[model samples]
Target chain A: MTEHVEAKSATLADELLGVVQAVEGVSAVYPAQPLWQSVAGAAVAAVTGEQLPLISLTEQDGTLAIKARIGVGSPLPAPKVAREAAAAIRRHLGNVPAVVEVLVAKIEA
Target chain B: MKTPGDALECGHSLAELSAYLDTGEIADPAHLDSCPECQAGLASLRRLSELGNELLTADVAEAGSGGDDWMQTILDNLRLELRPGRSIPLRAEDPQDTLWETEGSVSALIRSVADSFPGTAAGKCRLLGDITEPGAGITVDVEIAVVYGHAMEERAAALRNELAKMLQVQTELDIQAINITVTDVLELPAPAMTPNTEDQP
Candidate 1:
């Protein structure tokens, strides 16, 4: 029974390692702390009153990519943050527009 | 402060009523029962709050899931730049020329290591210590989100090992530590056309 459990654990670890290694620019992955959960949750709640934005940075074809959801208030304003976010991406990719495109995925209710 | 019209007509102030509505404190609470104006104002504010809640629900529904097409579209549009915050000296091929890599590049490398895991995603990342100076000790801290149901401890351990290996190979920052904080665990709905997509189609 112990051997079976150890083997299953090892398999899970190996699968996770493979996934982490597959991301283009990632050097590591780890469990989030409880404190971060509260702080980020509160911050996100204050901003949108909805779930927090899921933030991620990845490299696609040697260029960096950032993924997130931008919450807008009703009577939705022009997406100014969308533009600013794009600019931030541009700056990260060494001012390369070809390599960067800001994607806004709206979370479903 | 008291407004003139309500005070003159009914011996009651709209300002006082408004304050009372907000704070639930009134000098003459019973008088509000006879005041049609105060009742009307309170009703309006209550309705507005209800509408606000409805709008909030709608907007969140529109934000869609991380794996949803809305996110996919946004991701497609956002070409993020590498955060090379500092210039780390690299061994120059020419004796006089400086060979260097940016702190952004190293951070990008770290992110790549984290993203390699399925059901795991990376977030705001930071580098500790003065990355501007050569051979400065730097600690890498990263925020990440995992899909609900993924084994976090297992994933985290894998990421740590992978990053240690890659960072050791890539940069000369005196490595102190790598902190991974799971800031969120997202509940991604099953793949389908989100309501917005269906509307457009």
Candidate 2:
């Protein structure tokens, strides 16, 4: 049950990642997790045959918290892009409560 | 053709990009335009190259030749560190959802703004404050070099004001100050029209 829930959480985060990428002014999505987690995720994925997400999903105080790092394009304010991306993720979450964190890792202008 | 770029994460590196910028000899020119990683790498490498040129020009103009290894050293160090610095928080739609931007991205935006001014090339940029904390009073410290003939004070002042406004639009950091340091006086590069005059790759 725990493994199942964890996989489901990762999938949901990956789905939101796709949604954020589709948002306007977002140019690229980078790995939000630290190098250690990235390596661990890659290893676990190798065994489970699951495609891991670049973003991170954590359970904090009974809340599903998702973190994303992305690059924004020029001519559009990065703050605007980050807000739009976060909004898209929240809209996707719908009635299912989630804490979406969007980080603009780069501005590719 | 297949140069071993740094870590091969994108099959491209700053070193390879730097060589291409100098020699115009990439095995596949099409790759540069289509590959997003190469394009990103090129943008950063190009800007750094411009700054390197400024330093070298200043050296050549002042004494004689810029024969020292300083330029190479700078390039080596820069290529190693393309950090996406501190994550500065931004206001989100709800208290749960969070928004933020990295200091590196802000620096890139700042460099682009500085480039708009004539005869100015930006170098190291830093946000000196606890950017992770919301509404922190942040100071933007940027280094730039200008052509010998241009007015450094006017250009720096203009860049400072422009950076301030851009930061407000792009971030919520409190208005502390934007400090522009004139690092060196550069000699103007030769016209690009003479590229054909040089030996072809």
Best by lDDT: 2
Tens-place lDDT per residue, model 2, B10-41, is 35567677789889987667545433345545
- lDDT of model 1 at residue B193? 56
TM-score of chain A of each: 0.32, 0.79
Best by TM-score: 2
Clashing residue pairs in all predictions, respectively, total 44, 0
Question: Candidate 1, after superposition: displacement of residue B112 in Å?
Answer: 1.9
Q: State in Å the error of residue B95, model 1.
A: 4.1
CAPRI-style quality class for the chain A–B interface of candidate 2? acceptable
Model 1 ranges off by over 4 Å: A1-109, B1-83, B93-95, B188-201
Q: Which ten residues in a row have the lowest lDDT in candidate 2 chain B?
A: B61-70
Candidate 2 local Cα displacement, residue B117, angstroms: 3.8
Off by over 4 Å in 2: A1-11, A34-37, A42-51, A59-62, B1-42, B50-81, B116-118, B188-201
Give per-residue lDDT, candidate 1, residue A7.
Answer: 60
TM per prediction: 0.36, 0.71
- After TM-score superposition, the amount by which residue B17's alpha carbon in candidate 2 deviates from its true location, in angstroms, is 6.0
Reference A-B contact fraction recovered by candidate 1 = 0.00
- Write model 2 residue lDDT over A31-64, tens digit each, in one string: 6763334677657755795545667778767777
